[model samples]
Structure formats: C-alpha cells, structure tokens
Target: MNREFIKKLCEETHACVRILEGPIGTNDRIVLISAKEEPDLEISPAMDAFLRVFKHVNDISYGTGGSTDQIAAYFTACSVWLLVASQQAINLIGKQGSSIKSIQESTDATIRVISGA
Candidate 1:
C-alpha cells in the first residue's frame, strides 16, 4: 500500500514473471534446475497475491454458480488490479526522478481511463 511496499511488490512481480517466462539458454536451464532441486522455492509476496487472484478467478469461472456476468466481473477485477499495480510501480520509480517518463505517463493514462470506466 505504501511506496516501499509497492516498489518491492513490483520487483517481485517482475522476478516472478521472468522466472515463469524462462529466458533462453543456460541461465534459464539453471533456474529451472534450481527450482526443481529446491521444491520450496521462495515465492514473492506479489506472486503469492497473483496466485490467489488466479485461484479465485478459476474457482468462480468453473464453480456451479458460474455465469457470463460473473466471469466478466472477475476479468474486470483482474484488469483493475493490474492497472493499480502498474500505477504503483510507476509512482515508486518516478519518485526517484527516473527517466522512464513515457512509461509513467502511459501507465497513468491507462489507470485513469480504467478508473473512469
């Protein structure tokens, strides 16, 4: 919720994405091997949150009460979460007077548009 928390969350999210996406070649292979060797690989807080969201979406999408409206709402919630996370990341980085102005601007605009909707 705070700036520091958001910054850490963004970093973790990026790490989790990279690990899941798997880069090319030896480094990728090492990460995979390490993951397998250490079954209890540490999951970042952000990734944990994402997994929870994913579970909820899956449950809602497949449960007995599933409906078109519910599925739509779930996806909408996911989009909002993503936008908020991105906005927080941009804010945290911008506070240091970094040079990613275009990314920050675009993220702000997307958040605003989604919030307006």
Candidate 2:
C-alpha cells in the first residue's frame, strides 16, 4: 500500500476517505472506505464514528476483492466527485437558484469538471 499517497488524499478530502486494516470478521482485509456524512462539516463527526465501528455483521466494501491500487483509485475518484458536488451546491445557493433546471445545470457542471470535458 502507498501509505503516503493515501494519507495525502485523506488530508485533502478532510477524512472523507479512509483505510482500515484488520477489520472484524476478516482475517486480513485492508479496506479503503468512503461514506458521505449528512450535514457535512469540515471535520465530519459521522466519518469519525464510521472509522471506529467495525463488526462481522456489517462489512461495507465498495469494491470487494480488488487490489490496493484499484481501491485507492476508487477512493480518490469518489472524493473528487464529492468535492465537485459540494462546490456545485454552494454555487447554486450563492446564486439563489434551487429550481430543477438549476440543479440539472449544477449536475452537468460537476460531471464536466470530473470528466475533464
């Protein structure tokens, strides 16, 4: 695992993406995790809780049986999408536009930003 790369990504995303080692029920599973915390904050309380709780009952892996590189890439892409979406919402609010057309435009812009189109 490229620990440095992941650490930097987590920092950039404000702990939105994390990696956990030896979670419960798995003999050996190093999982890269992402969850969108509602009522988001710069430091998400829900994210902190998620990192703490682990059990054999609820094991959430975005992509099971994937390599470390693939997991890292998935996490990074998700973080980028979140960032873009947040920005779009903020911009929409700033314009005082919350109509369906405005939302559609924001979504389109977010897609373009992430896809580099």
Candidate 3:
C-alpha cells in the first residue's frame, strides 16, 4: 500500500516503476517504464493487457482494501506478465534501427498515457 513496499516488489520482479507523490489534494501516481530499447508493435497490445490488469489491481488496493501480501501477489503476477509481453515484443521485432526506435518511443508514449504515467 505504501511506496517503499511497492518499490521493493517492483525491483524484485525487475519491473520499472516510478511512484510520484503529489501535493495536497492530489493523488499519488504509479508509472511503469519500459526497459527495452526496440520493442515491437505487439508492445501496444501487451500494454493494453497490462492496463486492464492494472485497473483490477487498483480497485483491490484502493477500493476493497486488500492485504499487503495480496497486493504484492497481484503486482508480482502483473510484473511477470509484463516481462513476458516485453520479451515477446522484442522477439517479434528481432532487430534494432531508427524505425524500430521510433516505434518503440511511440509505443512507450502510448503506454505512459494509458497507464497515467
């Protein structure tokens, strides 16, 4: 539920997460960044799946008041799925270049928007 705990979980799972705490009356933000340089177009689809899962996780963590362990477990599952999706995207792309880099950034930006990062 707290920043440090979620951060630790993210690190253990090798996921890139940036938690931003806002000013008074503002809610904290959780951002997931891509570690890959040239992921495929499939990355967008993977991100779509991640967003859906994230919504459920958010509901459980903020709405239902799940335990720390439960949240941790759900996050772990999400992280694993994200990693697999990233890997799959990379595998599908297979090479790096200016075009691939452009696509990667585009996809990353799309993910950031969708994830509210």
Candidate 4:
C-alpha cells in the first residue's frame, strides 16, 4: 500500500499488457493463433500478485473501517491496473472479445467506486 508498491504494480501490469499484445512487428494472424492457445497464460503471474495485494488491502480496509484515504488510494491503483490489463486482453484476444469487454467494464466500475466519482 506504499508508493513503491503501487509503482511496482503499475510496472508489472504494463509488462503483462505488453506480453499479451505479443512481440512487435509479428504477423497478426500468427499472433492470433498463439493467443488463442494461451489467452490467459502470460498475465497469470502478474494477476496473482496483484490480486494478493488487493485482497490483503481489502481485508484490512474492511476489518478496521479506518485509513479510508489510504485504502481508497490503493484500490484506485489496483483498479487502474485491472483496467489496463483488461483492455490489453480485449486488444489481443480477438476471439474472446466479449469476455474481455466484460472484464473491462467490471474494472471500470470498480475504479469509479474506489475513486468515489
């Protein structure tokens, strides 16, 4: 829940997004083939780490009902990461477009709730 942790989460999320998008300048069709085979593979580690931290913060936030500011900030950061990750999924997984859209929408809603806007 510190600045350093938030920074690391953003960096990891960016890397996962890039991995989902595949290597640059590759054939789109071939990338699609590989993506179809392992749509959820590359982002698993980053997602796992993010979820662990997120759940920890959520549990603490609920248990204490204090530090609302800090908890809100952490939730906001996590929501941003989820938003970016889901958008990357949508961009990369053509065959699973609808599923990715749902993820993006869900993440967007979470962001709104966390940001109180």
Q: Which has the greatest TM-score?
A: 3
- Minimum summed lDDT over a 10-residue window in model 4 is located at 28-37
- Residue-by-residue lDDT tens digits, candidate 1, 17-114: 21233335533211111111233657644444455344443565335232435545655443433433556655645655453455547544233323
Instruction: Please identify model 3 stretches exceeding 4 Å from their true place.
Output: 1-14, 30-32, 38-41, 44-53, 60-117
Q: Encode model 2's per-residue lDDT on 21-81: one tens digit a residue.
A: 5647767544445656647465454344333222111343533432435434434333221
Top-scoring candidate (lDDT): 3
| Candidate 1 clashes between residue pairs 3 or more apart in a chain or in different chains | none
| Candidate 3: Cα lDDT at 90 | 55
- The positional error of residue 78 in candidate 4, measured at the CA in angstroms, is 12
- The collision pairs in model 4 are none
lDDT for each residue of candidate 4 in 1-117, tens digit (9 for 90 to 100): 555754565565442322245337863211110111335565554544545355554564435333435556545454333333454644544564555456568645432212212
Residue pairs with backbone atoms closer than 3 Å in model 3 (clashes) = none
How far does residue 62 in candidate 4 sit from its true spot (Å)? Answer: 14
Prediction 3 global C-alpha lDDT = 0.44
The per-residue C-alpha lDDT of model 1 at residue 77 equals 42
**Regions more than 4 Å wrong, model 2:** 16-27, 32-117
Name the 10 consecutive residues with the lowest summed lDDT in model 3.
108-117
Off by over 4 Å in 4: 2-43, 60-81, 85-97, 101-117
